[model samples]
Target: MEMLCEIHPLHEWRGLLSQLVKMAFSIFSIIGTLPIVIVFGLYFIITINSYLKTKNLSTIFFSLSFLATTLTYTVWGLRVFLLPQYDPHISNLLPYWTSAYLFASLSLIFLDFACIELSGIENKRIKQIIYSIILITYSILVAILFIGFEVEITTFMDVSDLSISNIFVYAYFILLLLFYLTLPNIVFINYIRTSILKTSLTYKKVRTIEMGLSLFTIGTILDGARFPSNIGILIARILIMIGGLIMLIGFTFKPRAKED
Candidate 1:
C-alpha cells in the first residue's frame, strides 16, 4: 500500500503568529497522547504491585505489556508532534516508529498471555510460542526490508505507510501484522466477555474497557488511514485521549465479593 505522506512540517511556519500556531498543535498532539501514557503507566505500576503481592505470573505479563504500551505512545509521539525541529526524517523517525511497532507487538503478546490467564485457560506454553514466533518474524522482516529499501527518502511521512516494492515481502508483512494483532484481540475480547458474570463491578469494568478499546481503535484508524485534514488528526487524538481515560477507569474498577 502506498503511504500518504502529507506531513505538515512545522518549519513551514515562518512568522511569529504561524510559529505560535505550530507550537499549539505540537503541544496538543503530544498532550493528546500523554493520557494514554499515564493510563498505561498507572496500569504498569498497579500490575507490578499486584504481582509482588500475589506472585501471579499473569500480572507480570500485564505489567510488561502496559509498560510496553506506554513506550509505544512515547515513541509514536515522535512523528505525530509537528515540532519545528522534529520533522519526520526517514533516518530519525524510522527507528522510533519501528521500535514503537516492536513495543506494540510485544505488548500484544503479553496481553494475550495475560488474557489467557485471566480467562482461566492458563495455556502459558502456547502463549510463549506465539510470542516467540511474532518477535522472530517481525525482527526478520524488518531487517530484510531495511536491507532491501536502504532507507531511501520516499514520499511517505509515516514508515507504516511505505509502499512495499516486493510482492512476497508485502504479503508476508501483512500476515505478520495480522498475526500480531488478531490473536491478542481475540483472546482479550473473550476474556472480557467472560469476566462480567460474577459481579456488577466486573460488568461496569468490562464495559468501560470495551468502550475505551472502541474509541482507541476508531481514533487510530481515523489518524492512521490519513483522513486528509488537520481537524481529523486533532479529533482522532482527542478520541484516543478519552479512550485512555476510560481504560484507566476500567482498570481500577474491580469486582467485589458477594456480601453475606
Candidate 2:
C-alpha cells in the first residue's frame, strides 16, 4: 500500500450530482459501515469471553475475522476518503503495508481455520495436522504480501484498485484467496444439506447461519472489486454493513460440531 505512490488522477466530478454521490459513498462507508464492523468485532471478542464459553475455538477465529474485517474497512475508508487529501495522517494511523489487502489475507487465514474446526471432523490428529500446515503456509504467504508491499510488487490504488506488477505472484494470491473463501462456503452448503432439523427452531437457526455466511462472503467479494462509480461504492458499503450485522446473528446461534 505504501509503495503505491503513483496516483492515476481520475476525471473531475465537477457536477453537484457527482459530488453528492461521492459524498454518499464516503459517508456510508465511513460513517455507516465502519462503525458497524467495529461494533460487531468487539461484540464477538467480548461475548465469547463473557457468556458463550463453548469449547469450540471457532469463536476465537470468528472474533479475529471481525477484527481483520474492521481493519479492512478502516484502511479502505482512509485510502478512499483521507489518503487523497490527508496523506500525512494516514501514515500516522497505519503502517505502510497495512492495507485492505493485507487485512484480507489475515481474514482468509483465520476464516479457513474456523471452517475446518466447524466442518465436523472429529479426528483430533487430522485437525492438528491441517492447522499446522495452514499456519506454516499463511506465515509464508503473509510475509510475501508484506514484502510485496515494501518492494512495490503489489501496489494498490487509493480507491481500492489492485495493481499487479507480477502476474505469477498475483495469481498465486488470487488462487489461495479463492480456495480459502470457497472452503467455508462449501462447508456451509454441506451443513445446510445435512444439518438435522429436529424442529422448526433448529431449521431456522441453521438458515440464519447460512444467510449470514452468504452475506459476508458476498460483501467481501464486492469490497475487492474496482468501482467505476460512487454508486457502486455506496452499494458495496451498504452490503458490508448488513453483512456484519447478520454475521454476528449467525455466530450467536452457535450450532454444535465445532471443537476447540
Candidate 3:
C-alpha cells in the first residue's frame, strides 16, 4: 500500500499564499479584460459600420479580427475566474482554444491586408503569395495548438509540473516566438523602406506600433515563463493586459499615406 506523505504547516501556508496569488491574478485579469472587451466591441462595431459604408474589405477584416480578439480575452478572463471551481476537462477548454484560433486567423488576415495596403506593395502577385503563406502558416500553427491542447488536457498537472516535451507543444511555441520576432521586424522594415516620403506623423505612428509590439513580445516571454511560481504568473498576466492595451492604442493610429 502506498503511504501518503504528511502535509506540513509550512506547505499549507505556501499553498494558501499560492491560492491568494491566483485569486488576485484572476480578479485583475477580469477587471482588465472587461474594459478591453467593451472598448474593442465598440471598435468592432465602428469598423463594421465603416465597412458597410465604404465597402472596404480591410475594414471588414479588421472588424472581425477585433471581435475575435475581444472574444478571446473575454474567454480567457472567464477561464481565469472559473479555474478554481471548474473541473478540468477538454470540453471546458475548447471554447478558449477555438476563440484563440479564430483570433489568430483573423489577425493574420488583417495584418496581411495592412502590410500590403500600408506598405504600398504594388505587386499583386507578391500580395497574393504573402496572403497565402500567412493562411498556410496560421493553419499549421492552429493544428499544432490543437494537438498540444489534447496533450495538455490528457496530462493535466499543476503549473509547476507543466512540461513541454510534446512535439506539438514545442512546435506551437517555437512558431509563435518566430512569428512575434519576424513579423514585427518585417513590418517596421517595410514601413521604413517602402515609404516614399515619411513624415513626422508617419514616423510617430510606426514608433507607437513598434512600442506596442515590443511590449507584446515581452508579455509573451513572461507568460511562457510563468510556471512554478504564482508571482511570476501574476506578473505575466499584468504585462499581457498592459501590452494588449498598448497594442489597441497603436491600432487606432492608422498608417499615413506617403506624401507625394
For all candidates in order, the CA lDDT equals: 0.61, 0.61, 0.58
Q: Candidate 2: worst 10 consecutive residues by lDDT?
A: 150-159
Which sections of candidate 2 miss by over 4 Å? 1-33, 49-55, 78-82, 86-99, 149-162, 197-206, 254-260
Runs in model 3 lying further than 4 Å from the true structure: 1-29, 80-86, 101-105, 144-150, 153-165, 200-204, 224-260
Q: Which candidate, 2 or 3, has the higher TM-score? A: 2
For candidate 1, give the lDDT of residue 152.
35
Cα lDDT of model 1 by residue, 116-212, tens digit: 5544555778767766776688678667755765343333222222344567766675576556545545665776667646455545655666677
Checking candidate 1 for backbone clashes, the offending pairs are none
lDDT of 1: 0.61
lDDT of 1 at 29: 57
Candidate 3 per-residue lDDT, tens place, 56-84, comes to 66556657766765776676666665554
Candidate 3 collision pairs: none
Clashes of 3: 0
After superposition on all CA atoms, what RMSD does each candidate show versus the true structure? 8.6, 9.0, 7.2
